[model samples]
Target: MMRPRRLPPCLAAAILTATAVAVLLLSASSPGGALLASRQSPPPPARPEWGPGRPPSFAYWISGTRNDSRRALRLLRAVYHPRNRYLLHLDAAADAAEREAMAEAVRGEPAWREFRNVDVVGEAYAVDRTGSSALAAALHGAAVLLKVGAHWDWLVTLSAADYPLVTQDDLLYAFSSVPRDLNFIDHTSDLGWKEHERFEKLIVDPSLYMDRNTEPFPGTGTRPMPDAFKIFTGSPWVILSRNFTEHCVYGLDNLPRKLLMYFANTAYSVEAYFQTLICNSSDFRNTTVNGDLRYFVWDDPPGLDPLVLNESHFQNMVNSSTAFARRFEEDAPVLKKIDDELLNGSSVQLVPGIWCSNLSKEQGRMDVESCLKWGDINTVRPGHSGEKLWRYISTISQTRGCS
Candidate 1:
């Protein structure tokens, strides 16, 4: 989001980090994790009871590079919910101390500690957005989420620059009714210009091999598009179903691995790999929803990146009613505005929701860092934004394109 723009694919991590995170799983070893790995519905994490139509929980893979720990933490707090699971990561460019600091901040929260739904990747390797390593990093994050906590329904990827436009409750409430098998990925069979620049561009991501001093753009070469399968490209950001992520990771079918090998040499593979895989796979093609549910303000000519949002974009952003927006400046006034105007909470404090019920009830509650007490996490009290988001998702879910 800052420099070396993040290739946002809602779920992912690094192989190097996988070796080190062997012991940091937030939830204890349980059969639920195994069930999730086997692509079945795992028992929900031990939390409060609820009535019918309980909202779906998300597994967020929030990644950042060097010097982004605070920003990542800020984003985590903004989206935190007892219902969801979080895996925070500072990539290889970031040092051990920064990773430790990020972990410490996550531990600083009482609700997170009580629920044990958050974790920080202790080890990392290079991740270059312009190369296939970006895709690798995302895959790694998905691997970790699948490994550690398997209770979440959907996998959401967030960069430090991204902030939620809708509160966690709103997003969850909206998604509560959607079919679990449906995947929300913006896609098009029309490659147009990307067919040459993206699919045909053969490149080597140095980060895949090295540990530091990542070269921004990898060297490139030209090759014809793959004849084996049709290629699809669209917004890198996606809200992937757990089954889809498992399909990507477990590789029960050879298509995922075949595409992985093919895209490993292609530049910005994160933008196309998932799209191509889902669209090509017979089982998942019809489940595609043709929208990523992210709000962005594009440049006049629409350059490689979206325009950096600021105060001027607030009303328009709210009008869009998307779940998240990207590329905000660190601690920008607009963030404060979103916290106050939209979220109905403080920028520094967790978004007020049913889960944080006891925080408001307690007398002289001094700890601002943690929600000392909690309420029924399964109970969802959706705000107006939540209702609008539900409608937005319902309308978009009817669109077609993955085939």
Candidate 2:
């Protein structure tokens, strides 16, 4: 693919630097240590392979707010791969200067240049997780990812606070044997305590129409919760299939459209929109596996946000068997541990994969032969933990989805 020059997302400013660019090219002795030398070496020539022969590719929509550009880049590198697609967005909360710098940084990466699969949204949109505006932003990202390419099978949404528990290779290998149509979203129809506060009550998100942030307003009147369609709600984080995403974005389904309008007046609609829409549509309900493929710890009573993960959460995070986890503090030391122990990633270099060949550890750079060459993009070679993930998925797969 011809490389496309685009701006970096809000969190990748250092990605634009020539020095930092070469730093990633160089190999490191340890994950957190200084770069040592180039370790790239030429390999015997072979004809390039493509399509199902390689690992499955993902389309990632990584979103964050102001002052989150660096953390976004770190997460990006942690999950980066040549075959997958990425779309980054910084909400209106970030100023124009931060947004532009992020875009420029993405353009500076050699691997991103060779594959041309990464992009940052230059335009700004208002978003507040406290209301429906966050869902609007997510859907907007899905629209942009669709416009970027047609090759990806799934769409995963992540925040700057989230980090991977496994490498791209580990994640791909674990998912390779599974059906592509299934979505990993934790959902439930049993609203429990949320029925009165979330379903019956109504609120307005001024971010939907206002140029600046405004608190949500309670509706003057309350409406009985609808039985027209079963209401479902879950974690906002999701790994959605491209087919289902298309259903939400372009399908001629009235339920999806109706739910969007209904949830516009609901608080924290990002958590409810897809859950309600997917379960209501008989076509998609069976396809749901009811897992978000992420690990998170909620405060008791479950406040507006989850606990911010730190070093103390490291061991549990690794043992969770989830692909990712969230609410991590920026530049947490635990992240460095993950890069070293799990992903085999360096401080700034992307998590290595089969796609990356000819790495040089001594000189700390990829030689002229270091450009990402194509391999079996659809196949996967799972690691030790990858097998465990497959087993966990199998168990989750057997349980009938939430009623």
Per-residue lDDT, model 2, residue 343, is 77
> lDDT (CA) for every model shown?
0.76, 0.72
The best candidate in terms of lDDT = 1
Model 1 has an lDDT value of 0.76
Clashing pairs in 1: 10-157, 12-138, 12-141, 12-142, 13-137, 13-140, 13-141
lDDT of 2 by residue, 275-325 (tens): 888888878888899888898888897887889888898899878989899
Q: Could you tell me the TM-score of candidate 2?
A: 0.84
TM for every model, in the order presented, reads 0.87, 0.84
Q: Locate the minimum summed-lDDT window of 10 residues in model 1.
A: 1-10
- 56 in model 1: Cα distance from truth in Å? 1.0
